[model samples]
Target: MEAESRTFADAEVNRSLTPEDKIRFLRDMYRIRRFEQTALKAYNAGKMGGFLHLYTGQEAVAVATLSLLGPHDHIVTAYRDHGHALAVGMGMNECMAEFFGKATGCSKGKGGSMHLFAVEKRYWGGHGIVAGQTPLGLGIAYALKYKGIPGCCLCFLGDGAVNQGVYHESLNLASLFSLPVIYIIENNGYSMGTSLARSSAFRQLLAQRAEGYNICWDQASGENIYEVRAKTQAAMERAREESRPTVLEIATYRYYGHSVADANARKYRTPEEIEHYKTYHDPLLLWQKRLVDEGLLTGEQAEAIDLGARAEADAAMKFADESPFPTEADICADVYSEVDEPAGDAPRGTHFFN
Candidate 1:
C-alpha cells in the first residue's frame, strides 16, 4: 500500500519545540537572510572577490535541517552554502572574512567564497563543481558505517546536479553498500538559467527516481522550517536506526542569480513570479507570522531580531575588512601532507613556481 501523505498545516504545530527554541530558529533564519544581504552589498561595491552564490530565500531549509544534526552526523553541500555554514555554528566573522579573502577566514583566505569548511563542526567544505560533493558525502557515510558509528551524512545538491553521472554513481554505491547518507536535492525550480521542466526528465517528483536504487524518497516544501525538520528527522532516524540511504528533495527557490555572476537571472523568469514568492512564500516572513499568530512572538520583537541580524552582519563585514591577508609564502601551504608548516620554504613538488 502507498504510504500516507504528510500534511504540514500553516502553523505546523511543533509542540516539542520550546518557545525559546522556536525564537532561536527565527533568529538563525534572519541571520542568514541578513548575511546574504550584506554579502550582496559588499559584492556590488567590489569589496569581495570570487563567485558568491548567495543563500537568500532558502534559509529555512539549511537552518532547520542542520539544527537536527547529532554528534555523529555530518553535512556537505554545493557552492550556495552560507546558510548551512551559519546554521552549523560557523561565526559570521570567519564566513564573511572568507568572502573577503582574509587570513581569518574558515579556509584561511585560501578557499574564498565557495569553499567554506568547518571539519571540527562536522561540516565538510562546500564544493564548487556541481555534484562533486556527492561522492565525498558517500565517503563520509561509508566511513561512519565502517567505524560502526550510527550517523548519517547529509549531502546537499542543486537540481542541476541531478543530471551528473557521478551523482548517480554515488547513489548506486550508497544503496549497494547501505551507506547512511541523505541526498537533499534543493530543487529551486531553475537550475542556473534553465528551468526544471526544461532540463530534467522526471515523470513526477524528482526524488521519485530514488526508487531505481531501492532507496526511500520524499519531497516537501522548503518554505516551512517545521516541515523541513519533520521530514529531515525521519530521514535521519532511518539512517541511524536502519543504516539506510534516502533521497530527499526540498522544493526551494533562490532569489539571486545562480551565482553573483549570472547577469540573466531576472530575464529568465518574470518579475511578477519573483515578487509572488517574495511577498507570500518568503520563509522568514512565514515563520515570523506563525510565531506571532501563536502568541509566541511579538511584532516588535521580530523587528528587533531583524535589526539585530543586520547589525551583526555589518559588524562581521567590518571584521573581515580589518583582518589581515595571508602571507605570500602561504601559497604552497595545505597542498601536500608533508608540508607541516604553513610558512615553510617549499613543498616536495619540483614544479613549484616560487
Candidate 2:
C-alpha cells in the first residue's frame, strides 16, 4: 500500500482526552507549524545561521507522541526536531533564540539549530549526528530501569539514521536487557535526497526488523493525531509495565528538503506528489477538521488559535533578534565539570590539548 493511502478512520480516539485537552493539542500543533514557518522565513531571509530542518509536515507525530509521556518519561530525537522541542514544552523564545545563535538558546548558543537540549525537561537533546543518539537513548532507558524508575524513553530517528550501524547495535542491547525504550523511525520517505526505497533494504515496514531482535514492532500513520497517540501509548505502556523495548515506524512526510541547504528538493520529487500530501495529509488541517467535526471547536476558533500561534512565533523571532550572543569569555564555561576545573579538587591531567 502507498504511504499516502494509510487508513486513519479505524484508529480509535483516545477517550481520556477532555475537550480542553483536545483543544490544547490543536493549539500545540499550530504552535509548531507556525514556528517552523517563522524559522523558514528567517532562514530564507538570511537572518538565521546553521542548518535549519523545518518540521513543517510532521507536526502530529511529535505532538501526539510526546503528549503520552508521564513525569518520568523522557525523549530524544534527531536534528529535524523543532516540532518535538515545542511539543515537549520548550519556550519559543529560547528555541528561536537558538536559531538566531543567541546565548539564550537551550544550549546557551553553543549548539545551534540541531542541538536543542533541556535536561531539566527530560528532553535530552536535538542531536546533529545521524543515529548518534540511539545509544544515548538506550543508556537513558537502562539507567531508568537500573534506578527502578517507572518510566520509559522515546528515542526518535529519521529513516536515514536507521541504516547506521550504531542504531542496530542499540537495538540489540535494548532487547537483550529488556530496557524500556521505544525506537520511533519517522520515515519521511526520503533520506537527505535519496528516497527510502532506494536507500534502505526493507521488505514491508522498517519497524518489522524488530522481529529479529525479539522486540515488539508496529506501524501507524503520522497524519492523524488520534492514530499517533493510540499507537504510541500502547508502546509506552508495554515499556513501562513489561520493561520491553519497541520499534514504531510512523509514516510521515517533510515539506521542505532534508534541510534548507538542499536545493533539489522539488527536483527530486514531483511537484504533484508534494501537493497531494499538503492537500490531503496535512496534519494541521486534518486535526482542525476533526475537532470541528467533533463539536469541540469551530472554524473561527481554529483560525484564532492559528493566528495566536503565528503571533507567538513572531514575538519569539523578535526576542531572538534582541537577545545577546555568547561572549568570548563564555567559551570554556560549560566545557569542564567543577571538579575538573584547574583550581578544583580533581587530579586531572592532559584533559585539553591546544
Candidate 3:
C-alpha cells in the first residue's frame, strides 16, 4: 500500500538519536514496565487501595511523546496515567507512595491511582471521569494563549472518550479560539472491554473529523515508539508555534484489563491476540528488536536494562512502604490552594473552611 509506505518513510529511524538517546529510551520504557509489574504485585497484596489502572502496554506512547515537551508546556490525560506522570518527570518514590496512599504522594495520597497531579512538573494529571480532562486541557491552552506563553497543551484520552459530548465541544472551541493544543486519542483497540468497532460510528479515521473545524490531523502507529515520536513532533510544532489545533489518533494496545480488575479481556478478544501482541506487537520488544538489528544494542545489554528497572522499582517500593499516610483531621486540608497561615487565629485552609 502506498499510504503505508509513506507512513513508514516518515518514521525512518531518526539518525539524530545518539547511542545515549537510544539507551535512555530503552531505560525509560523498561522502567514503566517494571513499575507496573511491581504495582500489580502490591495491588494483589492489598498494599495499594482503590482501583488500579495499569498502563502496562502503553508505556511507549507516554515516554516518547512527553520527551518532546519543555518546562512551559502543559499536559493532562485520562485515568490510566502512571506512565505519563513519570514520563513527565514525576519521581518514582512519590509515584509508588501515591499508589500506596502515602502522604508524600504527588497528590498527597489523596488522588490514588486514577488521579495523580503535579503542577510543578507541568503535568495536570489524570482525571477519573471519562472525557473530563479534555475541557481542562483546553482551558490550560487558553491560559497559555492569554498569557502569551510559548507553551502547548497535550491532552491524552482513550478511544472511548472521543465519543463523548465534551470532546466535540472542546474540539470546536479550540479550533475557534486557535488554542495551542494537540488532542491525542490512544486507540488501544478497546474502550474498557468494548472494542472501537462497536462504539465508534465514525467509519473512517478519527482524524478525519478535524477537517470540519479547520484543524490539522495525523495518525501514527502507537505500537512503534519511533513512529509516535516523529509524527507527534510535527503536530507539536503546528500547535506550539503556529497556534493551531490538531487531532492525532494513535493505534496502541493495553496489555492488562481496562482496570486491574477487568480480567475478562479474553472474553472480548482472543488469548491468541494477547500472545501475538506480546510477542511481536509489543512496543518495548519491537524497539529492542530494532536496536539489535541496527547494531545499537546487544541482547545482553537489553536484558541488563530490564534488570536495572526491576531493581529500581524494588527500591521505590521500600520508599512507599516507609512513607506516612494522611491523618483523619487532614481530610479538608488540601482541598484548595493556600499556604499554611503562620499560626493565625483563623483556621488553616480557605475562606469557607477557615
Candidate 4:
C-alpha cells in the first residue's frame, strides 16, 4: 500500500472542529489528566504499589485514537496504560482497585497498574515488557484476518520501542501478511532519560521507516486531539478496508518523569521547559481554549468538567482504600493453571508450588 501524504494547515483547520465534538474531546482529555493526578497522589500516599507510569501530557493521543476505534476493534499498549484503559471504557473504580491490588481490578489484581486486561471488551492488556506487545498485536490482527473478522488492532508503543528489533520485525511481518493493524508510536521526545536525537541515529522520523516496509504511514501532532483523531480514523479505515498496516507517529510530551519514582525530573529537563509545555502545549488546555473560543463551552462549563473529573477520581480512591488486599492463598491459585507433582520425596503440605 502506498503511503498517502496530507498536512493540516494550522490557520485553515484550526476552526474546523464542531462544538459538540470539541466538548467531548475536552472531556476525554480532562478525564485522563484527573485520573493521572489521582494515581500520583495514591502512589505517594503508599496506597498504590508497583510500577506507576503517569500519562499526564499524552492524554490527547490516547483519547483521540481510542475515539476512532469501534467496539469490534482491539487495543494493546505499553506500561503507561492507565489512560489507554480508561479510554477503552474501563471503569475508574476498577482501575483504581487494580492499582491498590484489589480483586475488583480489571486483571482481578493479578496485573497491577501496568497489566490491565479487558478481554470481553477486546482491550487486550497493558504489557510491561518494552516492545513486547508488538508481536502480540500482529498475532491479534492475524487472528482477526484468519477468522475473517472485519476489525483492526490498534497497537500503541513509545518512541523507545522503535529502536528494538521487535518493532522492525513486526512491521515487516505485518506488511507481508497484509494484517489490519495500526502501529501508533507515541514519540514524547525521550526514551526514559535518553532523548530521541541521542538514542536514534536516524534523527527521529518514524513514518519514514514505515515507508521502507512498503506500508502506509503518517505523523500527527499528539498535542492536538483533532489531528490525532482525524489521522487515526483515516488510518484505521484504510487498514480495515485494504487489509494492510499503517504507522502513526504522534509527537507528544510526558509531563512527569518515566514513572512517579522520578520526583526530581529537573536534573534532565529544565523547569522552564516543563512550564512551557504545561502552560502552552498542554493538550487539555489547547482543547479547552478551542471550545471556549467556539462558544461550545464557557469557562465555567470547562471548569465544571475538571471539578467533576476530580470528584470521580477522589471517589475511586476512597473505594480503593476500603477494598481488601488479596490473601496469601489467592496468590497460589493464579500462578498455575493446574497443580504440579511435588518434588521427589517431598510432602504435600510442606512445599507448595508458587
Q: What's the true lDDT of residue 141 in model 4?
A: 94
The TM-score measured for candidate 1 stands at 0.94
lDDT of 2 by residue, 1-354 (tens): 434333433444476678898899899999998998998898888988769998889999999999888999999999998989999999999999998888998888988889998888899999999999999999999999999999999999999998999999999999999999999999999999999988999889999988999999999889878778888988999999999999999999999998999888888899899999999989889888888988989899999999999999999999998999999877767887753365645645754565
Better of 2 and 3 by lDDT: 2
What are the lDDT scores of the predictions, listed in order? 0.90, 0.90, 0.86, 0.84
Tell me the deviation in Å of residue 301 in model 4.
0.6
Q: Which residues of candidate 4, in runs, are more than 4 Å off?
A: 1-19, 336-354
Compared with the true structure, what per-residue lDDT tens digits does model 3 show for residues 1-354? 447534653564444568788778888899999998998998999998778888887888998888778778889998999999888878788899999999988888889989998898889988999999999999999999999998899999999898899999999999999999999988888998899889887858877787888889999887776678888888888888899988999988888889888878669988889888888779888778778987889999999999999998999899999989999767777654443443455455445534
| Candidate 1 residue 283 C-alpha distance from true site, Å | 0.5
Better of 1 and 4 by TM-score: 1
Candidate 2 worst ten-residue window by lDDT? 1-10
- TM agreement with the true structure for every prediction: 0.94, 0.94, 0.93, 0.90
Q: What is residue 267's positional error in candidate 4, in angstroms?
A: 1.3
- The superposed Cα distance between candidate 1 and the true structure at residue 293, in angstroms, equals 0.7
